[model samples]
Target: MEFDGKTFLTALGLAFILEGLPYFLLAERMPTVLRFLSERPAPELRRLGLTAILAGLAVVALVRW
Candidate 1:
């Protein structure tokens, strides 16, 4: 498939909106949630992050297929 700048930008913008939505809607609880995450062990955080990455990749692959 050809590279499409517009599509890329649109996806990036959507991602930013999704990323910010929780903070915007849960402004009060976010700090507590963040603190909890911060206290987690490094390996636990890495495993969580890796899971998210794999899930994202699977979604993208399925969408593009």
Candidate 2:
């Protein structure tokens, strides 16, 4: 699938909206979540981030295919 500038921007905007929704709705719980994340080991956080990236890539690949 080929991407155009507009499509890329739209996807980025949508991602931003989805990412922000939790913080917007759960403003009170954000600090607790942040604290929990802060306490996690760096390696664990790195693995978690890598997993998220892989999951996102899988979804995008499926959708694009």
lDDT of 2: 0.96
For residues 1-65, write the lDDT of model 2, one tens digit per residue.
67699988999999999999989999999999999999999999999999999999999999989
Candidate 2, which segments miss by more than 4 Å at Cα? 1-3
lDDT (0-100) at residue 17 of candidate 1? 98
In model 2, the Cα lDDT at residue 61 comes to: 100
What CA RMSD would candidate 2 show? 1.5
> If scored against the real structure, what TM-score would every candidate get?
0.90, 0.89
Question: Model-by-model lDDT, in order?
Answer: 0.97, 0.96
For model 2, what is the error of residue 3's alpha carbon versus the real structure, in angstroms, after optimal superposition?
5.2
Candidate 1 lDDT tens digits, 1-65: 79999999999999999999999999999999999999999999999999999999999999989
